[model samples]
Target: MPERPRIRLVPLAASLAVFALVLRAVHALPDTATGLSAEMTAGAKASGIKNVVTAVLLDFRGYDTLLEIAVLMLATIAVLSLRTDPDALSRRISGVAGPVLGALTRAYVPIMIVVAGHLVWIGSSGPGGAFQGGAVLGAAGILLALSGFARPRWSSGAPMRWVLAVGLLTFIAVALLPLALGGTLLQYPDESRKSLVLLVEILLTLSIGASLTSLFLASASDTSEGERR
Candidate 1:
């Protein structure tokens, strides 16, 4: 029989200590377990946003959300940088689209656009927001790319780059604007809070959609059949 490996006392002790700390933290939880719901609800009301999630995300925790979008921008840039094919953005999925896919895409893309717009607009008072709307918009773009139904001529140009950047740029601009007026960063002036948030959401939808589509185009280069003429 093989000799059994000896368990290290030091590691065992460390593991026990970590487990003890976790248990202690768990035990410290309040019996009622009310959580921060009350505070968050108050904050949402103070912010004048009917959607608590949106208020928390775009208002109370703006910096974190800002960093999230910035991360997405960075990720898109990284994906584009790593692409081996120079003409990836100009390429589309190869092979002809079947009539069914072509027809569905033609009918669905417009509806998706309208749905995305509704999501963005209703976010302030409902369940949807920029991220949700952007995701849908991005999905529509992906559907178009996959079906090879339509590829915009402007997709590979500087305008597309601008679309990819407008979200973060506008977020940063809005965050800094408060500083010039003697307030903290991202402190929206009461009068224009809703307006600023709406603007940011709209730009974010565009940028997020463009970024996701660009990432797909860049990353799919190797797998695609051939560049379209």
Candidate 2:
């Protein structure tokens, strides 16, 4: 008899079956069960945040936010390690972008910064929050990089690193302080919840902005060298 091909399809089939079963189970969950949703809604109101999703992401499930930031940081570091020169692509792109884009970038950077700051400040009671603000700030950085106003070498790596860490460190500090005071981590019953949430949001905004900007520049630099050749 002829030998069968070595490739296995049984495991793949089994995994697909398992995934389908899990999806079905998830779909069967009660849509009307208001337990988790209600709690989040109440937390949003109590924290004075208008956006329920932001409240859930930054305050109700703050530990998850920290982990998410860590994941982004780790992914960035991994990309940097694997790349020859990250900024190469962006730099080359900038070279061909022409003066119009450069002029627009120069004109818009300050406005973007102001808008990002406003979003962070109003996050406790608005649709905008840290992630939104961070994205806007990252856009500004991209503009700066593309316009040739700031190079990766000219930017301060140390200060940027500190900005990236500030949110995680602040969260840790707050959570640990509560634990040190004989309470559970992140249990902020004594202090004003709104205030605490706002502070965290602000730090997260800055940290995420800095981290994203660094990642963009790093990637651009890595890719730029290749394009130049």
Candidate 3:
């Protein structure tokens, strides 16, 4: 007979201890010296972006944004590799509530597109930025996919890939430009800081929006297939 796996309490205890230590370290920080508050105050005047949080995410800590974009790209690629054919699933769904859902999705798609555009455009100056805006756009894509309007196919693959890559590539290129000019990587000491921040934000918004849309569509397709089976 095959042996059953045994639960080891030591590893679990160790994990809990480590987690507690990390939490304690985090809790010990002074309120005024918090990363967010410090970043906000430092970036508020120079970022040109009216929203402090957005400025921090895209400008002050842009390396974090780059890594986030990379993570999103990896996730998108993973999901796409595992995604089911949307057409097959749509055919199955269409037989039942297709028309009703289709109408609703079509009606809302325009509004979603507009909102996403607005979010991306105004992100530098407001609460929304590339990540949030891209999410909104991705949500719109999901709505379309669910409603059976936009079927996933290999033809749309190129644009999707470009969208996924653009943000990260842009960020890398821009970051390197500063380094080439004798500034540190991702540091905009030469050019106006606001200009550099805006450039990064634009790329991030595009990259984030595309990555999210692709991931959502791929996951939705997978879930729909599993349900059918």
Deviation in angstroms for 23 in model 1? 7.0
Under the 3 Å rule for N, CA and C atoms, how many clashes does model 1 have?
Answer: 0
Compared with the true structure, what per-residue lDDT tens digits does model 2 show for residues 1-229? 9998786799989999999999999999998665687778887777777778878876678778878877877876666577665446545655444679767886899999999999988776667898999999888877777676776543335676677788878877776767877878777654476777778878878877877877766655444345779
lDDT of 2 at 165: 81
Alpha-carbon shift of residue 17 in model 1 (angstroms): 11
Higher-scoring candidate on TM-score, 2 or 3: 2
**lDDT for each candidate structure:** 0.86, 0.75, 0.71
Q: Give the TM-scores of the predictions, in the order they appear.
A: 0.81, 0.78, 0.75
Candidate number with the higher TM-score (1 or 2): 1
* Predicted model with the maximum lDDT: 1
Candidate 2 local lDDT, residue 62 = 74
Q: What tens-digit string does per-residue lDDT give for candidate 1 at 161-185?
A: 8999999999999999999999999
For candidate 3, the TM-score is 0.75
Candidate 3, number of clashes: 2
Each model's Cα RMSD? 5.6, 5.1, 4.7
- Which pairs clash inside model 1? none
Q: Residues 91-165, candidate 3, lDDT per residue (tens digit)?
A: 544533366786788788899878877877787676677777777777876666656566655214787788778
**Least well predicted 10-residue stretch by lDDT in candidate 3:** 88-97
List where candidate 2 sits over 4 angstroms from the true fold. 1-19, 86-98, 154-156, 221-229
Compared with the true structure, the alpha-carbon lDDT of candidate 3 equals 0.71
